[model samples]
Each structure stands twice: as structure tokens, then as C-alpha cells.
Target: MKDQTIEDWSREDLKNQWLCWIDTIDPKVSLKEGDSVVFPKKRIVVQAEMTPLVKSIFARWERLSPSERFSAWEQLKEATKEAMKDVLPSCIQCGECCRKGSPVLRVEDLELLRTEKIPWSALYTIRSGEPVTSHDKGEVFFLVDERIKFREKEGSRECLFLDSTSSLCTIYEDRPLECRAQACWDQSGYLELENQPYLTRRDLFSHIEVLWDIIEAHRSRCGFERLYGLVKKLKESTAQREAEEIASKIIDLTSYESHFRSFMAEQLNIPFDILDLVFGRPLERLLELFGYRIRIEKDTKFIEIITQEGPFHEEA
Candidate 1:
């Protein structure tokens, strides 16, 4: 769920969830023996005696105004930070955080993108699925699933926009909100406190508190859905020339499909002859031969292919 929707949850419910999560980690609480809690690289036996009280405070926090809420959240986060100082591990800069499959844009991000004069086609392209347009508001943006997939699969499991060679963002200043809000195990300063076992618990709690604060803020903002709507609207309202220009940037269909077929065949270690029988020939013939199906709408610039994995591509 988007942060905005999260914000809509009753304060009490949110608090209860938070408490439940913490309780799962408490050593003093009832936990099955041999049960383990996993962190990035560490797993610890469930202790039966520690109970951290964050949910109660969080519940009381909901009645505050946005500014006040943020402030309170920050304070709580600081406390957690102080407590968990010792157990946090340092990041090895594996670049997993910048991976491509995570969706970072929200409505505000899309609106901001519009302020620039770059043609939408040159700036972004729809992949994996059709652009979703808001029927009511006419906003358009990339779908969340697409964004997630892009982040997950593109550029070696890092973000496509992340420059691996330089360890920099291609769109640093314009990166999405989710990207900006991200903090992994190392960013919270817990690694520096790793030697301080007495402070480990506090530090871990603080890290989580900070994370939840961001989540709550996002829920309140409804940023994710807004971005989707914006992207959809843009696609719908794009000028014909602009749309064509964008379409031109996409890999030509013949080349893309050929390459895709070859790649898939190679990945699966299937023979090229079988691949041709599966994906080659006229659309109807291909469908009849191996249940391969394609649908191309009249006047649309792409073709949709139905495969065992569902509709795989809509390429120009």
C-alpha cells in the first residue's frame, strides 16, 4: 500500500501493528525455542525477556498535525538509533539498494517531470504493461508493477538509472521519492555502534522507527497512486508527434522480438528450432502451433503476446 493509504489507517491499528512487530523480536516474550530472527547477514536466537514499547507512543502520535507528527516520529527514531548502535552492519556498497525493480515515483514525481520540456516519449516508455490512465482525473504514469520490475531486473539488479561504473545516479536530482527515502542497514549509523552491545537493541529499534516514519509519511501523502495517475494522464494527453517520437525510440518490433526469442531460448537452453516453432510464423499460425497468441489493436503501435507466463510484451 502507498504511504498515503497507510496514513489513513486508524492510529490505534497502526500502533497495534507496530507493537506486534516489536513483540516478535522481544526476548522476554513467548517464542518457540530455536526460532531465529534474521537480519541482513545475522540471525539471533529468540530471547524471551525484552519488550520494547514503541506502539503505544506511536498510537498517541496520530492525533498530531503533520508537522508535529513528523517531529514526534523523528524523536522516536533518534531513540531507536541510540539503542541499536552496536548490531548494525556496515554496507559493503554492493549497490543492491539502487537496483532497478523498486518503484520510486509517486504522483508528485510525475507532476514534477511534466515541468520539463523533454518529450514524454524520450523521457520514459511503457514496458511490461499498458499505461494506466485515470478515467476520472486523466492522470497517467508508469504502473507500479512496471516500476518494480524495472528496478528489479534492469542494470544488474540495481536501478537502470544508477551508473554502476561511477556509483552515481543518472537522474540524481530528479530521482523518485522512494529512492530518496531508502535507507538500508548501514545508513542508520548502527554499524559504527556495533561494538557497543548494550546499545544494540536501541540502535535497531531506532532504525526501524525511522523507517516507519517514512512509511507513515508516504501513507499520508498518497504519493504512489498520484504518480501512477500522472503518468497515465501524460500518456493519454501526449501530442501525436511526441508519442511517435517516443515510439521511435523503442527497439523496432522485428529486432526486439528476434532478440527476445534468442535470449529466452538461450536462457532456457532450448533449441532455436523449437523457439521458431513457438514464436515464429504469422500470428495466427504461431498461436495454432504452440498456443502462442498475439493481439494487435487497430491503430495501436504495439502487439501483445500471450504466453504461458501471461502477456509478455507489447512492443512497438
Candidate 2:
């Protein structure tokens, strides 16, 4: 019956349920190894009962309205203020924290980027499935799920703002909200920040949401998603001719990327760099994820592709 109940609980159902309370048995209360007490009208289950519950809640959070999410974000900021009251150790300039990874950008941090205080090239987004350190959840209960985070450079996990010689953040005065809130030595501080709401892509960049939507539409309408889906299918299929045909189609579609670029520029007035920042770069990353390599040569309008351990080149 417990298994059935678990199976029947949907992601939405889990979001609505909370751990109301748990029993606290006195230290002097006698009990046997195999014995259990029956509450007259209630039932009890193991602590592990909450695992799937939390997972479900986390997964479906994207379905929440923007207003709902922002409200939660505000609450978290208030909690962080309270958490900061705890005694935190002074920084000794060890550089360990700065070395670990870049401080992720919060909603308030976007202003720095908008003002060009931080260059876009120095920033990258860890998309929904990429591995990331969940500072909001802490290391002890580390979340191994895809939550969008604004990371620094690809090669070095260190923050771009770190000054190597001084072992201090170069942009200390303009550091992100997470950076200001962090307390490396305080366990309770970590716990307090756990499960706090994060800004969604839409929340941070609503001005570009229309562009994102258009790119998404193009991805669906064009064979972009289908091309990758075919690649996965080709990997599992036994037929060689079918595989070649799919690979050929994939190469053919690569040429259309320019058309997409032109269409966006002429119709939407978005420049090449901004388009690349918002969509093209991430699209390339997505293709790379599907075990395909794309090299675009703008000088000659050339594209190079490798699939099935072989090279394919297309020219515009």
C-alpha cells in the first residue's frame, strides 16, 4: 500500500505535501529492536519516504508562475539576512573558495552585466541538465539535478573577478548576491540558504524572452531537434544506408543556420553577437552534447561535421 501510494503521487502532488510533524520519543521510552507502537488513528513510515517527494517538487517548480517564484525568491533573501546574523569566521584570503567555482549570478546581479561591468564572454549558462554546485541546497544534501546557473568560463571554474596576486575578488564591491551571502565556516548558514528560490531565465531576462521563444519555435519548426533525434536513432539502428541518409540530412540542415541568422536579423533586428549569445552558442553546445562536432567558418560560409566516426563538410 505504501509503494502504491508513492507510485500514485505525481510531481504536482509532491509539491503540495509537506512534512507536517514527526514523533519524538523520549530517551527513557522503552522499545524493542523488532517492536513497533501503533498510533490509534495514524500511520508512520521511514524517513526515506520524503526522497521522491522532494524530487517531484523540485522537478515541477518550472511550472510555477513567475510571480509565485519571485515571491519565494524575496522570502529567501529575507531568510539569508537572518542567517547572516550567525557568527561567521573572518576570511583569511586562502583562495580556496574562489578556486572551487565561479559565484553564480543572481537576479540582482544582472544589472552588472547590463551595465557592461562584466563582459558577456566571461559568463556562461549551465543549462537545465548541466552539473552544478547547488549553493542554495548546501554540500551535505547536494542536489545533482539540472538547475540553471550563470557560471564563469568553461576551462577554469574560478570566478573571473578573482585577483590572483591579492587572493581577493577584484569586483568585491560589486560581487553577486550569493557571494555576499556566503559563509564558508557556518553550517547553519548553509542550511538556512538551502531550498531558497532561484531566478528563472525568464525572470532574469524577460526582455529577451520573445527572442528565446522565436528561437525555440525555429528549433521546433526547422529540423534542428529532429536532426539530433535522428542521430540518436542512427546510433541504435542496424542499417548502414539509413544511417548515411540521416547523416546527409543532418549535414544539409547545418547550412540553414545562416538562414535562421538572416531571418532573425532582418525581421527582429538582432545582431549576430547577441543572437549567438542568446541562442547560437547554446545551440552549438546542444549539438555537441549529441556527439556531433560543428565548426563554422564564417569567412567561407563553411561548416564541418563529424558523425559515425567520419567527417562531413558542407559549404554555403
lDDT of 1 by residue, 1-316 (tens): 2455434646755544444545454322112365332232111111111114244445566676666666655554444433333333433333445642333234435544457521222222232233444312335533433221222332244555666675566666666554554434322342333232221112222355643453244233333333233333434545867545433323143334445556655755646533322232222222222223334568444423333332222111
Q: Candidate 2 lDDT, tens digit per residue, 1-316? A: 2453433444444333322222332112113464322221111211122235334435645565656544543443333333223212444444556666666555567777778776665544433323233444333322222233334445665666777676678777776666666544433543554455544445544577777687566545543345556666767767878766766665556556556767877788765545544443344444554557555466432224454552121100
Clashes of each: 47, 0
* Best candidate, TM-score: 2
lDDT of 1: 0.38
Which residue pairs show collisions in model 2? Answer: none
> What TM-score fits each model?
0.26, 0.48
Query: With candidate 2 superimposed using the best TM-score fit, by how many Å does residue 53's alpha carbon deviate from the native?
Result: 52
Candidate 1, residue 18: how far the Cα is off, in Å? 36
